[model samples]
Target chain A: MRRVVITGQGTINALGRNVAETLQAMRDGRCGIGDLEFQDVERLSIRIGAQIKGYEPEDSFNRQQIALYDRFTQFTLLAAREAIGQSGLSFSGELATRSGVILGTSGGGMNTLDENYRSVYADGKNRVHPFVVPKLMNNAAASHVSMEWNLKGPSFTVASACASSNHAMGQAMQMIRTGMADVMITGGSEAMLCFGGIKAWEGLRVMSKDACRPFSANRNGMVQGEGAAVFVFEDYERARTRGADILAEVVGFSMTSDAADIVMPSKQGASRAIAGAMQDARLNPEDVAYVNAHGTGTTANDKTECAAVADAFGHHADDLMISSTKSMHGHLIGGTGAVELLACIMALREGVIAPTIGYEEPDPECALDVVPNVARDVKVNAVLSNAFAFGGLNAVLALRAA
Target chain B: MSDSIKDRVIAILAEQAMLEPGDVSMDQSLEDLGIDSLGLVESIFAIEEAFDVSVPFNANDPTEGDFDISSVKAIIEAVTGLVATQAA
Candidate 1:
């Protein structure tokens, strides 16, 4: 099987608008969760989220584009542009035909849905926009990315709740490994901080009002976050021949189903996925030095994830470092795993592990070394990114330095 | 009016707890009634819709929220207070 490697990455998240700015924020250990700024935010019981602060669509796209693209699609296109631009590849002939796009998102055009619903139900409008259905479809972002980049190969979107991004990226990697595509522009995006979005999630009661303190005894719950992250996954040999700047190698990926609970997590399922990724990558437990945890700061997720890690790695669990960048970026839901993979890439290439910021107190249940409150500078050869969704869907990816 | 409010609160709690209103006890805590955290939130929503009064409850830190949800009796009293304040 051919190897897959990441050639370029870009993101517009709560942490930053691009790869450099985001890595810098991680290094500084900044808190991006704050009072959300959007229409009807005052009406929400939970008033804070890690929202993109000063983005203006007019500055990035034309008026026609803005009318057709939802907030999630806009974010995806922006990140995709940056990633493809950085990769320095212009698609024209067979290269274009041999490339595709796969993205993950739970709320495809939530902003459009919320607005149209408001206009019809709240404002009593007789007619809605004709583009509403096209804009609001779940595969809109993936289709748009493929169209923009001229990719004709396998193109689709994956929506497995919180594990969406990881599942999408894993599929992208497999496509390149099996020679289905030489390159794939893959990642995830989410724009669910609107009134309807927050209202729907509020019903779940798994959100924090103040902060996301993952693994902290004083932690309340996960905070909702919005934005997107995109990457260019290319064949390793192709990237090497073209002298592309390889960021990290996609060494392994594995996904599993709990078949246990719909909303609650299962440790056995999570551990098996983790173990399965390492086995696929042909890496020993000792080879992994860091883990980007799926720590959502909820009362149920943190301890359960720690137990899963313990079961997966046995004695090596205590030696490796695991931290949740979600504490800083908040939980981006479907797009979260994509952004957290940046942390894994950073740890492998830059040797700076992002901290689980807002970590106030430690819990014995989560006894691992959760590089708390501050970023750690340590060299790491390999790392794992874990994403466990609400429906007991778990996906883990193993990465190594390029 | 207060009696009506109490009856509505009891009905909502009973619905969330999956018990008949006759089977519910005023002194029983939400947990004792087998209403988990999500059920408690749903009960709060029912109360708000029935009375058109917002309950200042944040599920992240339920105990610290201003809305009292300790027991059926306590929830009824809190909803009554919110209704009165909104009316005023």
Candidate 2:
């Protein structure tokens, strides 16, 4: 199998619009959750969310493109544009055909669906918007990204709830490793901050009323967020020959199914994913310096994930610096894994572990270090990002310094 | 009839449609308040349930102008009229 390495990374979240701004916010331990001002809701206890501010479609796409794309698709396009731009990879001729795009999203175009539903059901309107179908589809984000960059190989979207992006990136890595594609643009995007979207999540009753406080004793639940993060992955030899700036090497990736409860997390499933990823990377637990946990600030998730880490790493679990960037960015749901993967890459490259902000009082059940509320300078040779989604899906990716 | 009722109605309207209370006035058309046709329908539905009154709409006419259903006061008036008519 060919070796895959990350050449570029891009992200747009509540923290910032690009990778640098986001990384700075993470290092500074800024919590992006606040009173959601996007839509008015009646006495909603769940008022805080990590909403992307100051985003305009005109800044990223043309008028025609904007008409066909939903907010999630627009976000994916923006992140992909930044990743491509940073990679300096020209999508021309054979390269375009040899490249692919894979994206992940759970609640795709929910805002569009909510608006149109209101228009049709409540207003008794027969006419729907011309772009509603294209805007509401799950594949729309990947389709938009592919069309924007003219990628022809193996383009599709993965929907594994929160693990969506990890599944997408893992598949993209497999494609490159198996020589199916020389390069792939892969990531996830989520824009479920609309009125109806929040209402739907409110029914789940797992969202926090305040800021996300992962691993904290006072943690209530996950705070919903919206954003997109994408990475440009290419074969190491091709990247080196092209003099591409290697961000990090995709050392390992593993996916597992708990086959257990739908909403309740499984420690065994998460442990298997971590063990499998470590095996795939040919690295022992001692080699890992940091772990970007799938800590969603929920009581069940933090405890279960900490147990999984302990099961996978044994004594090394205490030594490894574990943190959840979700504490600052809120939970991006589908896009979270990709964004957290970028955190891992940044940690491995910059030798700085981003903190799990909002962690005040640690829960005894979740006794990991969690790098609470403050960024730490560490020599990270290898970093692991874990993403556990609903429906028993779990994905883990290991990244090494290039 | 009371200030509290008015405030509650206004708060619900603002929350449901993401509008400011100031945007909804006594004489302004609901449509003009950025309450789309669906929003108008939902608001009417919510108001009817809230006040326990039936709001009559001409089934044949479904336009923004048709929904002259203006302010909270106008809504209360329509509901009261509908209730009186039903009683008669």
Best by DockQ: 1
Q: For model 1, how does the per-residue alpha-carbon lDDT over A273-309 read when each residue is reduced to its tens digit? A: 9999999999999999999999999888998999999
RMSD of 1: 2.2
What's the DockQ for every one of the candidates?
A: 0.45, 0.02
Residue A355 CA error for candidate 1 (Å)?
0.8
Total clashing pairs for each candidate: 0, 0
lDDT of 1 by residue, B1-88 (tens): 4889888889988988889999998899999999876687788888879989877776656766678888888888888889999878
Native contacts retained by model 1, as a fraction? 0.41
Task: Give the Å shift of residue A200 in candidate 1.
Answer: 1.8
Fnat values, one per model, are: 0.41, 0.00
Q: What is the TM-score of chain A in candidate 2?
A: 0.98
